[model samples]
Target: MTTCPLCGFEFDGTALSCHASCAFNERCAVICCPNCGYQMVDEQRSVVADRLRRWLARRNPPVREIGEVCALTELRPGQTGRVIEIDAENPVRSERLQVLGFVKDAEVYLLQTKPTYIVRVGFTEVSVEQSIGAGIKVLVG
Candidate 1:
């Protein structure tokens, strides 16, 4: 069985071999996951890559639940969460926030939520207004 890197779906490669009729089937080593349609190279075709993938997967399992996601402002004081999404109305503001350490997958710790929302992302502590804090979503699990 093979596991998808993106969605963690596992299945036998041959079960989804509907790509046999494609023009590039002979040269293409890609396999598409039935669950999420994520195309990835078939690891069996490369022994080195297969071994590395297995090793990495063992170190960090591909399968993991995203858990509950909510606005950063919803987190209670002293709570920590993984930043999942930033719903900034402006693209420039979203990019700015990312540069300021509010990027997705970054861990955010709620320090306070009174006059302003104080969050610690990595080693940087940022004081944000309620509107900005509400735009940042984090995984609460």
Candidate 2:
């Protein structure tokens, strides 16, 4: 079984076998989500990868604290919080942000608000426009 990275739709990996009719199917590494048409690289399964994922999940469980939910833009620079939701008007834009590490339950650090909104999601610092930052809601204690 494979889960769509964007929509969280779980389906048999063979569903992607529809590319059997395509000439480049054998060499193509891209996989598309049937539900939302999101494309991503088809990485092979690895036991080490699975173990690391489990370990990381155990290390950082979901945050359940009762906290204020507000837009990422509302956070003061230097404040840290967990993402609650992204309310972008365009679904594709929301999914793109999710792919860039602003997904629910992930920790985010508001680095700065001036110039462009600079935020740290995991180890990557993402530069988001003010308009887009306003759509990402986070839970701040």
Candidate 3:
């Protein structure tokens, strides 16, 4: 779980938003200061940097990479396949993909990959260059 850098309040690791009434919702994840009721977003670059460092550290653990199901539309061009493993770290990308209603545990397939790899998910085909990351459970048949 991540702590509110501004208020020192602890929250769930997967939580992105603090609350609806938070003032910093426009800029960052809303985190309210319980003492002053000051609604703010944690914009500390160090926090992000630290998180990245941690991710890099855990990446080599050899966990069940791509063991969870995922959708085809979630894959994008020019992104590293390893991205899916760190979905929470990439909120912008996650949000973009989530808009399409594709989440973990969806089925997809790799079609072609020369100039760009095409992925077949559901009823559509998407071409991307980035590595789709691990932790996705896919069935090949």
Could you say which candidate leads in lDDT? Answer: 1
Worst 10 residues of 3 by lDDT: 77-86
Could you give candidate 1's per-residue lDDT for residues 28-56 as a string of tens digits? 56788999999887766656688898897
- How much lDDT does candidate 1 score? 0.81
TM-score of each: 0.52, 0.52, 0.32
Residue range with the least summed lDDT across 10 consecutive positions in model 2: 57-66
lDDT of 3 by residue, 1-141 (tens): 555566777655344445666564545544455544555545453467568778977643322224333432233332223223234356776665545334554455556545655765567666544454332323322
Q: Model 1, 4: alpha-carbon shift in Å?
A: 64
Compared with the true structure, all predictions reach lDDT values of: 0.81, 0.80, 0.47
How far residue 40's Cα lies from its native spot in candidate 1, in Å, is 70
Q: Which stretches in model 1 have alpha-carbon errors above 4 Å?
A: 1-66
Candidate 1 versus the native: TM-score?
A: 0.52
Q: Which portions of model 2 miss their true places by more than 4 Å?
A: 1-66
Candidate 1 colliding pairs: none
